[model samples]
Target: MAGIGPLTQDWEPVVIRKKAPTAAAKKDEKAVNAARRMGADIDTIKKFNAATNKAASSSTSLNTKKLDDETENLTHERVPTELKKNIMQARMNKKLTQGQLAQMINEKPQIIQEYESGKAIPNQQIIVKLERALGVKLRGKK
Candidate 1:
């Protein structure tokens, strides 16, 4: 007992609270409550929520699948000669010079020319960007 020091007392638990909702969230809640009071049906709200959730889930799944497929297919796939010709023709039809089309696709004009002339095969990323910019499909099954 003489060698023993003072015993430490147990500490009380501390509770932390989160901050109140922001003004924007409060305003949104008020608007939603007003809409509900104005006879917006509960069933309609439920359906809208369900649809939004479904769309978000589906989009996430689709993007994940697309990314996985792209990663698995990184090996250079040959492009058809006809597709190259068609891509060139489409660019010409849009009255866009090679440089302009390259700018639109965020690529160099020489790369575009090489792709069109079948001198070089483009990576999948470039192909996707070109498809989006040109509004045409340049790659096919290999």
Candidate 2:
């Protein structure tokens, strides 16, 4: 649909008429008419809707904060000094500059420099990316 040509149809299709209002919708209309007859204020309806939305939003934020805390706790180990040294040595052995290594790993040159200089501690995901690109393990054997 995005990159192709327009379609040409051979024949026109038959049209269908709309169905009558459902029993649920008719019942809802009667309830609304009764509420109007009983004079339920519009301001009260607005306040109820606003309170419901606020409660839902607050709970969503709490769930998001819980997930963030969990991820932070999961990163237990920091990158070691030897890992930084290994990254720099591997880049040199591969005849690659920091920018070249960054390009290979889809990271910024500054980020690659920071990792090599021990200015940044990479997470496990980034460590795996570096290991794959450099063909060397930054993590030591157990």
For each of the candidates, the C-alpha root-mean-square deviation to the true structure, in angstroms, is: 18.1, 12.2
* Candidate 1: segments with Cα more than 4 A from true spot: 1-78
lDDT of 1 at 126: 80
lDDT of 2 by residue, 12-96 (tens): 8888989886899789778888888899853324345554568788899999998877844455344578888899888999999
Against the true structure, candidate 1 has what lDDT? 0.79
Top candidate when judged by TM-score against the true structure: 2
- The residue-level lDDT of candidate 1 at 31 comes to 85
Question: What are the TM-scores, per candidate, against the unseen true structure?
Answer: 0.41, 0.44
The local lDDT score (0 to 100) that residue 50 gets in candidate 2 is 54
Candidate 1's residue-wise lDDT over 47-90, tens digit each?
Answer: 46554567778889999898877855455656568867877887
Candidate 1 residue 117 C-alpha distance from true site, Å: 0.7
Query: Cα lDDT for residue 21, model 2?
Result: 67
Question: Each model's C-alpha lDDT?
Answer: 0.79, 0.81
Task: Tell me the deviation in Å of residue 117 in model 2.
Answer: 1.1
